[model samples]
Target: MIHLTLIIVDFLTGLLAAGAWALASAGGAIAAVVGSGILGVSLFRRWRRRD
Candidate 1:
């Protein structure tokens, strides 16, 4: 009985860890996209001003 409880706890912990990792990955992807967009806009403005 105790072993079964432990196994269930372990499984739950692993599931939560996986969810946290997925959230972190998604956040990083969003940050990268926003950063790239900002960089692109800045470069565009600089190039336009030069002309």
Candidate 2:
């Protein structure tokens, strides 16, 4: 019975860790998208002919 409880606890911990990792990955993706959008606008303006 003790071993069964330990295994259950380990499994639950692993599940939570996986969820945290996934959330972090999603946040990083969002940051990358925003960063690239800014970079794109800056580069476009740099190459654009000024009046």
Best of the candidates, TM-score: 1
Candidate RMSDs in Å, in order, are 0.7, 1.7
lDDT of 2 by residue, 1-51 (tens): 999999999999999999999999999999999999999999889889564
Among these predictions, the greatest lDDT belongs to: 1
User: What lDDT would each prediction earn against the true structure?
Assistant: 1.00, 0.97
TM-score of 2: 0.78
Candidate 2 Cα outliers beyond 4 Å, as residue runs: 49-51
lDDT of 1 by residue, 1-51 (tens): 999999999999999999999999999999999999999999999999999
Among residues 3 or more apart in sequence or in different chains, the pairs in candidate 2 whose N, CA or C atoms overlap within 3 Å are none
Give the RMSD in angstroms, all C-alphas superposed, for model 2: 1.7
Distance (Å) between predicted and true CA of 32, model 2? 0.7
Steric clashes per prediction: 0, 0
User: Model 2 lDDT vs. the true structure?
Assistant: 0.97
